[model samples]
Target: MFVGAIEKVDQFTRPIHFIFRYYTGSDIVPGTATLFFVNEEGFAITCRHVARQILYANSIYENYLKFRGELRKFEKDPGFETQRTNLENKYKISAANPIRVLFNFIQCVSAYKAMTIHLHPTQDLAIIQFKEFESVQYQGYAQFLKDSRFAKQGRYLCRLGYPFPEFTNYQYNKVSGDIEWTKEGRSKTPSFPIDGIITRHIGEGSEITGIEMSTPGLRGQSGGPLFDPNGTIYGMQSATRHLHLGFDQVNREVVSDGQRRRVSNYPFLNVGQCVHVDVIKQFLREKKIKFYEQD
Candidate 1:
């Protein structure tokens, strides 16, 4: 039902591709997040968590650079190993800490010298503005649903995002001990669309702030657009809530591959939670950002 809507949404929806490495690991990990253009002036919307990571990337990398420089100064000393450990502790560079994080906006703008971010105080929403860009690369912008009252329960909606980290245009620079974007390998990942019925409205007090869907939102879909078959955006996918279904089996015997085996099972219902259109519109208006709306 949303084949055409996906095409329309894809025109403005873009992926933020990221590569990172842990402080104690040599492997580079790739990930993705989604965002959609709200205007022709290079303004886009995404999850606040996603924007936070982007905002912290510089500091994280710079901290690692400082640690590396300090370690190099002690490399020729007899107490090199001990000094290395001290440096790690001073920098709080644990094994799980990310030492490098690099991200690129995929097909959103021609080139941007800087990015301006506005984060909503209480909601998982954020705005990203590309600055000093030669041109906007996204084809169109989001048209939000005018009246969110029409987004009733049982209404089916589709969300679009880049959930799979299938792109490989990144590598770990062995010389610099950092992760960097490369010109080789695949540079793009495919956008996925999932459809589900609105199960309920989520709210604080009497004001509805979110839409809960019957299906779960994928990991990289956190900032994606939720729209109807008409291509009108209703919300932005924020997170997923897992409901414990209370169906648990302990040591149940089951036949598998013509053999009997004991198994234990527990199931949970995963559902998508989205930031509602009303909240999105309100935040945009508060920031004096331009956006489109349709009934």
Candidate 2:
């Protein structure tokens, strides 16, 4: 599991923080996502959503800041017609090409030169290639199970990830007009291990689509590798389903005046969704990326 951020201290320089999001003032992990090496040459796999953030988080965050600033201006000068007009115009322009903003931010920020991201057309899986960096090492890498017959119900599987940040140092610098992470806060300890049985296979009979595990896939676990006891990578943890239980029982008389009081503590089953390994294999073959799989 890896945690870090795309940090920007000034306009000319932005370094990609890999091992830890921030480690200066506080031990923290920002924009955390679990990633694993697919091959020896710095190629890795993660969820498409996480890759989206890694590539465009700053642009989205910057948009938020701009929107907030405009709103704040409106709050300060309620009768200023020009301020309202300016804010409205900003909104119109921003909505048109948000992706352009993201790529622009990437060019301005990311320390590394280039990155190639391949998103699975129909699946949540994604492949990330670090073109500039070489010699990146991991403790180990995973090889997928080539045969699809092993994806059976009641089969035990496990996944690993840095689910949630133990401590977050996310902060916005008002002066610099930039989002920054304090150099303090610790990464989530003991990389989470979620174990469960394969409840069933996704898709129609004889056409495997995905895998449903009996574990709720948490936020940070997205893009994590799912493996079995025999060291075969089965799939990638992608999502979870929240089956709501009954509402919470709370004393309305004491808790609130006379409103319907119901707590959000609903019992939810951990139904972890995983993208099948075959989907990943297809993607790799289409891209001609090298990977290991059992014959």
Best by lDDT: 1
TM-score of each: 0.93, 0.68
lDDT of 2 by residue, 1-295 (tens): 1111111101111112222222122322343456666766556777787677666656655665676676785676757667756765765434333322211111211244677888777777788776764344343456789897878899888877656555443454569644455666542233566788999888756767689998788777787777876557888888997656566544433455766564544455659998898888888889998988865
How far residue 151's Cα lies from its native spot in candidate 1, in Å, is 1.1
Model 1 stretches astray by more than 4 angstroms: 70-90
How many residue pairs clash in all the candidates, one count each? 0, 12
**Whole-model lDDT, model 1:** 0.94
Evaluate model 2: give its lDDT: 0.62
So what's the TM-score on candidate 1? Answer: 0.93
Error of 1 at 70 (Å): 4.2
lDDT, residue 104, candidate 1: 91
Evaluated at residue 244, the lDDT of candidate 2 is 61
Poorly placed runs, candidate 2 (over 4 Å): 1-31, 61-112, 167-174, 182-189, 204-206, 244-268
